[model samples]
Target: MSKSKRLMELMMTVNRMRKFTVRQLADQFDVSPRTILRDLQELSELGVPLYSEVGPHGGYQVLKERILPPIAFSEEEAVAMFFASHALRHYLFLPFEAESSTALQKFYYYMPGDVRDRIDQMKNRVDFLTHTRQQKAEYLGVLLEASVDQRVVTMQYETKNGYSERTIQPVGIYASNGFWYCPAYCFLRRDFRLFRCDRMQSVANDSTGIEPLDHRHIHLGNWEEHGSEKPVYIRMIVDLSREGVRRCESELWHVPHMDITPDGSGQLNQNVPSSELMYFAKFFIGLGNEATVKEPSELVECMKGILNEIMAKYD
Candidate 1:
């Protein structure tokens, strides 16, 4: 980048931040500390109110009461923003979906007609293939608000057994596997748990105030990252033939235990939750004879039982 462009961005970055270090600036800009020092010197000469403290825990800070002016986007930036906004619209259930849409629309309002035309062309070229939920999660917006305000929420939620009431302190809301899930501190369970937004029947905030969710106390983790969720099924291994591996490449990923030989045959060894046994059974059944069970006689028997049931129906 040219020095002028770098200087403008450097001022904007520093103005937008409360505090930053020379090392942080260097890393962010992919330059050396010496270059950052030179840039800082130039910015200082240009009357940017940058102050520094010399200590083990101290860094540079923008002088108090500074709000930077609005930034103008280049044509490339405007086009990229258009593509980004449309691409993210369908795929993930984001907390800031409404704000994001408004921002995207506002970005186009002041744009040059030529730049808007370029972005329109880019929008036509880009497409994201994703699944849309049949049921709308209207409570997601309310849940997001409650989480931000640190309010306790009382909810009637559907569970495996039946609907149950819960008083929860929502920590984070995330979307995975095509569903929006909120990780919260459940007062009933006295632990962190994930509550599916779609499974929420009714939700309302309690008037009582609580400490807002803090990053220092929050630990976001799930079964894929931790081994603490109880193992629900015996470890099962299934060897796949060459053709089977070819057809199941995408399905085999994210299973946690998978191996493949140079010849293309592979083995998938992982624990399946009993709740998903029928789903996995159907998956293996679809693989036909190309898949062979290798261990955990229970899985083999389960497959045989499913097969027997199918045969009985046919007979």
Candidate 2:
């Protein structure tokens, strides 16, 4: 293989194995020890953080967290990737930051000088994120991989009550409000459910994978929401204020079907799952006096009860 491809393979190997000696890598790649040493040094120079030990118990190790293995991309695909990555910059604390950044770097390297210059000129003009990065979901990578490979996984998950173990067949993964969630068929629940990736302590293959490899085992409602609960129709009204506008945008991000008046007064009609009515109530209450719940007395009652508790603290 060419030296660049060989270097990429070497880096991938070290990352997967976590640690390996120069002799081991040399033998694996059918190269001499000196060549392996040279490649390791080259990788370090190219920004791969590698460390070595002198003793028999130690070898070489990659310093940072493991990202996806390197994959080549053509120039056209690189151009397309630049725009896509730019769009997702708002999700800064994305689980695959290292991998995506590396891919962007490769795209930049492959771009023609004029193309690179034109893109660079607009790079600062198009910004996605307003705030700083949040903590990344640690187990998102494992969940993502398992979903792709049809691997059933056992995750040590932290629920509302406490931590417990769950065997899940991941059907889909999504992100919203800065949190990542996986929709999976839970063996424990004997039903479809949603899991927060951040709340997972650990994830491992459940007996190699789901036997017979069935994707139909899990049922998800849409590309976004997950559940089989009956739908709840919500009617809400809002004031035409700055905060109202902001709330409208945020609510519209999740529930696009909500109808806003021509004068931008409020969202009139919304249909969400009964399971998510609490979520809906909280969203409206969060808008302060700018919002009003017109239908579903249960939601209004829930909001009133919560407000009463808050008022009781002062009175």
Candidate 3:
């Protein structure tokens, strides 16, 4: 093999072997021991974290952090990878925040000059925007690790009722609309619950020897499928004017359940979570006459109560 190919293969081989003698590598690569020793020196200079031990049974071994072998990417693929990491800069916290930054820097540092120039030129033109939030989900790494390992964790959580300690086995963590959420199986609630990551005051491994739920089948994408007994749902039917339909398409959660006509008018007929009726009332109220809630007397009553409070303020 050519010197470059041999070096690359040797890098991968040593990383996989983790510990090997120079003679072993030389024999495997059909190269001289002197050549293998020189290659090892070069790899060490390139930050491969090699450690040598002088004893009959001690061979060289890679340290805790192992360097990955180089992989070739097309120009387009390289740019796409760069922007994928760039888009994440908007988030305040990431599971691998420091590592992500370090990887992106290394990636950019090695790009060809023309590719770097192209990336610089396109930096301002393309962007993936998300809402900016100040609250940091500090335990995202812990939650993610628990999810992957399927281990239970104990955390002090800030709940709507009050602060409470919880033991949960996280299915996964996800980001949406500038917030991080972890859907986990809560031992306290005896069901699956979605916890906002920022609300977690502290997180640690469960030392009580709590048995973790079998959440290997669950993941962020499909945890809702195996969700616990769902909240009460209230049937809601609403008529939307053309303008209302246009607005709802952008902001309404039930847009997919809307029945639209040729004139762009639509009717939303779906069951909404009963706990969110007050929010729905406020939203429909903001729509003024553009929306007409046709059913679910509970929501109508809630809307009336809100309107009454507003009039009382005037009085």
Give the top-scoring candidate (lDDT): 3
Candidate 1 residue 29 C-alpha distance from true site, Å: 29
What digit string (tens of lDDT, one per residue) describes model 2 on residues 1-315?
788889888878887888888888989999899999999898788777788778769898888655456666665666567978876667755657777887778778867898798788778776555434365567777777787777789988887899899998787677766667788878777666778777888888897454624665443455233444435555544343445756666644364444556666655455555666677667778878776677677778888888898899999
Output the number of the TM-score-best candidate.
Answer: 3
RMSD (CA, Å), each prediction: 9.8, 8.4, 3.1
Flag regions of model 3 displaced more than 4 Å: 53-57, 234-270, 286-297
Deviation from native of the Cα of residue 265 in model 3, angstroms: 7.1
Better candidate number, 1 or 3, judged by TM-score: 3
lDDT of 3 by residue, 82-138 (tens): 999999999999999999999999999999999999999999899988778999799
- What is the lDDT, from 0 to 100, of the residue 100 in candidate 1? 80
The better-scoring model by TM-score among 2 and 3 is 3
Candidates in descending TM-score order: 3, 2, 1
TM-scores across all candidates?
0.60, 0.65, 0.85
Clashing pairs in 3: none
- Residue 18 accuracy (lDDT) in model 2: 82
lDDT of each: 0.75, 0.72, 0.90
Residue pairs that clash (backbone atoms under 3 angstroms), model 1: none
